[model samples]
Target chain A: MKNNKNTVDPFENEPDFLAQFDKKTPFSVPDHYFESLPEVINDKILKKKSLKFGFDKMSYRILGPSAALIALFFVVFHFYNTPSGNTVQPEEFSDALLNEVSVELDDYMIYDVYAEIIEETESSTEQTSGNETENDEYIDYLLENDIDINTIIEEL
Target chain B: MEHYSDDQLLSMFAARESANYAFNLIVRKYQERLYWHIRRMVIDHDDADDVLQNTFIKAWKGLDNFKNESQLYTWLYRIATNETITFLNKKRKRFLISFHDVEGELTGSLEQDHHFSGKEIELKLQKAILTLPEKQRLVFNMKYYDDMKYEDMSQILNTSVGALKASYHHAVKKIEEYFKNH
Candidate 1:
C-alpha cells in the first residue's frame, strides 16, 4: 500500500485510483548481478575476438603449409615429366636405333630399305657421268678443228 | 572515472587509442537505463541481461558508423527497443505460442521468477499493461515510466509523432479502465 496521505489522484472519483500508484517495480536480482555484468560482457567480447584471431592463426599455420605442399608437388611433377629440357635426342639415325626397330620389321622390309639405298646411289652416278662426258667431247672436237685461240675467244 | 559529457566521450571514442575506454564509459552510463527498458518489455531478468549485452555489442561494433544527428541516448534506446521486441517475438515463435499464450507464459513468470518481487498491485499493473497490444504496452512504458518524449519515441519506433501520441493515449485509457474495474 502507498502512503497517499499527502497526494491527490487526477481521476479521483473512486477513493483509490491508480494515479497514486508508486511506479517503482519490486524486482530483485541475484547477488552481484550488476557488479559482475561489465566483466561478463567484456569477457564475451574478448572471447569473440580471440576466436576470430585463432581462426586466422589456424589458417596461416595449417592451410598455408598445406597449400605450399600441393604447389611443390605440382612443380616437381611438372619438372620431371616436361618433354623440353631434359629429353634425349639423336643427332642422326644410329645402328642402335636400327637394331631396336628391326625386330618390328620383316626381312623383306629390311631388304627393301637396302635396295632403295642402292637405287638412289646408282641414279645419282648416272646423272653426273652423262654431263661430264658431254662437256669433254665437245671441248676435244673444238681443238681438233684447229680454230685460232683468239678467234675462238672472240666468236665461239 | 570522472563524469564526461557525451561529446567528450564521443570525441575520445573517435580515436582508436581511447575507444575501449569510451565504450566502457558508454556501457556503464546507459546499462541500467537500457536494462530496465528491455526488462519491462521482456519481463525476465535473464532475458533482459542477454538482450542488454547484445544491444551493447551491436553498439560497439557499429559505433564508428553512428552519425551525430540524433542523440546517442536515443540511438541506444532504439537499439535496445528493437532487441527486446525481436527477443519477445522470437520467444513466442520458438515456443510455438499464440499472443495470448505468450502473455499467459509471461504472467506465469511473475510467480516463478525468484527475482521478480512486485507486490500484488504492481503485479496486477504489469498484467493489465500486458493486456494491451505489445506496441501499445511499449508506448505506455516509455511514456509513463521513462517519461520519454513523443518526438524521441517517434525516432526510435520510426512512427509518426501523432501515432505515438495516439498509442500512448489509448494505452493510458486501457490501463486506467483496468484499474477502475479491478
Candidate 2:
C-alpha cells in the first residue's frame, strides 16, 4: 500500500482482507447537499443571531423597568438618608472637589466644568492652548484626588 | 472556487463587513470533510447534518478567540470530534441506554439505513469497528479510513502520539478478531 512518508499505515502487515476493502464511506448525502450547505449554514447563523437579538431586546424590555425601579430606590434612599449620611456621595463629593479645583486653577477651568455640564456649551480651553504645563497640572490634580475625569465628564 | 489560506480567511473575518462572507468561504471549504467525519460517527445522514450544523455554529462563536495555536483544520476537527461524541452521548442518555446498547442500536440502524451502500466485507468491517471502545473506534477511523497522521490525530484527539498508535494497533487486532469470529 502506498502511504505518505510522514504517515505509516499500521495495517500494512495485516491480512489482505483489511487491505483489499475500499475505505470509501458507505454513507451518502441528499442531492445538492454540499452545494447548498453554506447557504443553509448561513441561514441558521442568521436565524440564531436574530433570535439572540430578539431575546436580548425582549430581556431589555422586561428588565428595563426593573432596573429603573432599582435606581429610583437608591435615589430615594439617598435623599431621605442625607441627614444621617456618613457615606460620601461620589457625585456630590466630586462636584465640590471640582469647584474647589476651579477656584484654585485659572478662571478658564470653571468654564471647563460648565462646558461638561451642558453638552452644547464649548469649553473656553478646549485645546488646553497646547499648554503642556497646565495639562500636566490638571492631570496631577485628578490623580491626587483619586478622581476619574471620565466619570465626572459622563455624570455632567 | 477560490481557495484562501487560513490567515487570509481569518483576516477577512476580522472586518465586520466581510466576517459573514469569510465564514461562508470557510464553511464551503471544510464542510465536506467535516460532514464525512461526523457522518461516519453518527451513521445517519440527518443526525450527521444536525451535528455538522452544530459544529459550525460553535466554530463561528469561538473563531474570534481561536489563538491559531493549531492548524485551522485540526481545531475544526477537534470541535467536530467533540460535537460528534456529545451527540452520541446525548442519544444514549436520551434513550437511557448503556454504551454497548448504543453500539448495538447504531449497528441496527446501519442495517436499515438506505444510504448505506457498502459491499458485504465493508459492512462487516463497519460492524466490527462499532464494537470498539469509543476512543479506540475514533483512532481506528482516523488512521485506517482518513489516513490521518498520528501528530494531527494527537492534536485533534488531544492524546499522545504513542497512545494513539497503541490504540490504533489494538483497534486493528480487535477488528481482525471480530472478522474471525463472525
Candidate 3:
C-alpha cells in the first residue's frame, strides 16, 4: 500500500488577523500587596475599635452618676411636696378654741369662775332627774362636804 | 471547627470592650473582595485603596447598628456600593461630567491601561457594558461577574428581582451585539 497521508503546518497557512490581540499585557500587582493587606487593615480596625471602645466606656461610666443624680433629685422633690403630720383636723375646732382660751386665761380668779360654772351646770342637770329622791341624795352629799351652793347658783 | 459567622463576629466586636480578634478577622476575610469590588467600580487602584479603608472604618463604627435582617456581607456590600456611587458622583461633579460621561471616560482609560491583562478583551467587554445605563451596568456586574443571585442582589441594591432580571438580560443582549460586531 502506498502512503498517501497529507501534512499541514498549523501555524503557517493562517492569516495574521489575531496577531495584535495575541500580545499579552500582563497585570502586575505590587509585591506582597494582598499579603500585607490584612495586617494593615487589622491595624486600622484595631485603632478605630479602641477609640470607639474608649468613648463607650466613658459613656457607660457617666451613666452611673447620671442615674444617681436623677434619683436624688426625685427624692428631694418628693420630700418638698409632702405635708407634715401636725396639720390640724376640722373636727378639733372646739378643742382648739378651748385650749387657746385656757392658755390665755391663766389667772386664779378666771380658773375659779370657770370651775364654779361647771359645778352649777352639773347640779342643775342632776336636779332634773325623774326621781326627786335621787336629787336629794346628791344634795345631801354636797351639804356634808360644805360646798358653796350660793356661789354655784350665782355663777349659774 | 468553631468558625464565626460575620454577624457573630460583628456582635462580639460590638459587645466586648477588647474584640481585636473579631475585628481583625473581619478585615482578613473581606479586604481583598471589597478591594477588588471597589477597584472595578472606581477604576483606580489608589482610589480603591482609599475607599476600601473608609469602608472598613465605617463598618467598624456602624457595626452596632447593623440588624441581622440581611447577611453581614450583603450589608457591607450595600455600604460599599453606596460609597462607590457617592465617590463617583463627587468625582463627576469635580470633572463636570454626567454619570454616563464618566463611564465613557472610565472605559477609555481602562482600554488604554497597560497594566490590565487581557486588555483588549476586557476593554471590549467594558465598552459594551459602558453603553448601558448606570443601574444596568451595576446589575450586570453583580450578576455576570460576581455571580450573585437575584435575591442577594435585591437586598444589596434595594431593587426588585424582576427589574434586575430584565436589566441583566438587556445588558447581556447589548454585550452579545457588541461581540458580534467587533
Candidate 4:
C-alpha cells in the first residue's frame, strides 16, 4: 500500500498488526449469559405487552367486574322489561338491534321467526282483504311495539 | 438450524407466535458482534454489557419502525454505536469531565482491568486510538479494527462515505504519530 507523503497507513502498513483486533475482545460476559438473555428480553416484551394492552392498569381490572355487573343488570331488566310505550326501554332497544342484525341469520333462525309472523298475519288477513285494514294493523302493531317496520320489510 | 436471511427473520419477527423465537435467533447471531463493537468503545466488561443490553432492548422496541433502508447488520451496528456514545456522554456529564478526561479514565481502566491481556504494543495502539476525538475513534474502530468498508460505516454513522474515508485517514495518521512519539 502506497501511503501518501503526508498520511500514515497505520492499519494497512503494519505487518499483520490489525489481526489482533478482529472480533476479539477482552470484555467478559457472565457464564451462560447469552443463554439466559432471550428469556430476559422475552420477559421485557411480556411486560411491554401488558402495559400496551392496559392490562396492568386499575381501569382495565375494574372493567372486568363492572362490565359483568352491567351485563347482569341488563339481563335482569330484560326479563322484566318495562312497559313504556313512548320511551324506548333498554330491553326493547336491544331486541330491535338484534332483530336488525339478525339479517345474517341462517335458513333455520329466519324461517322460525318468519314462519310464526306469516302464520299470524295470514290468519288475521282473513278478517279483512282491504289495504286499509292490513296496513293499519301492521303499522300500528309495529309503532306500538317500537319496531322499525322498514327494517323488517327490507330484510324480507 | 438453517440460517435465515434478514428478510425472512424480520417476517418471522412480525408474527406474534414466532417473534420470540426469531428474536432469540437474532440475539444469538448478533450479540457477540455487538458486544465487541460496544466493548471496543467502553473498554470494560460490565459497561460494555450494560451498553450492549440497552442497545438490543432499544432495537427490539424500534424493530417495527425499521424500514429496511439499509442492511440489518448496519442498522444494529448503528444502534450499538449510538448506545456506546450515549453511555460515554452520560459518564462525562456525571463526572463533570471533558472528552479527553473520559479517554484518560478509560486508559487507566484498561491498564487496571485484569481481563485485558494484550501485549504492550497492542495496549499502546488502543491508547493511541483513544487519544483521537470520540467521533474519529469510532470511525477508526469500525474501519481499522472491524475492517468495515467506508460505505457501511457511513450507513452506521449517518455520515457520507467520503467523510468517513477522510476521518479514517486522519485517525490513522494520529495513531501512527502516537506510536512514534510515545
What DockQ would candidate 4 receive versus the native complex? 0.15
Residue-by-residue lDDT tens digits, candidate 1, B35-118:
888988888898999999999888987789999998999999999999998898899899999976787788788767788787
Candidate 2 Cα errors over 4 Å, as ranges: A1-17, A57-62, A70-156
Error of 2 at A18 (Å): 2.1
- Listed in order, the DockQ scores are 0.20, 0.35, 0.14, 0.15
- Whole-model lDDT values for every prediction: 0.76, 0.82, 0.68, 0.76
Between prediction 2 and prediction 3, which has the larger lDDT?
Answer: 2
**Candidate 4's residue-wise lDDT over A5-116, tens digit each?**
6486443443343454433444456678778766776677778778877864756688778989999999889857856555543344446656764333333333334445
| Candidate achieving the largest DockQ | 2
Best by TM-score: 2
Candidate 1, residue B48: how far the Cα is off, in Å: 1.0
DockQ of 1: 0.20
A29-97 per-residue lDDT for model 2 (tens digits)? 788999998999999999999999998998799778888999999999998877544444444545676
TM-score of candidate 4 to 2 decimals? 0.64
- Report, for candidate 4, the interface RMSD: 3.6
lDDT of 2 at B66: 89
- For candidate 2, the lDDT comes to 0.82
Please identify which of the two predictions, 2 or 3, would achieve the higher TM-score against the true structure. Answer: 2
For model 1 chain A, give the 10-residue run with minimal summed lDDT: A87-96
- What residue pairs are clashing in model 1? none
Question: In candidate 1, residue B104 scores what lDDT?
Answer: 77
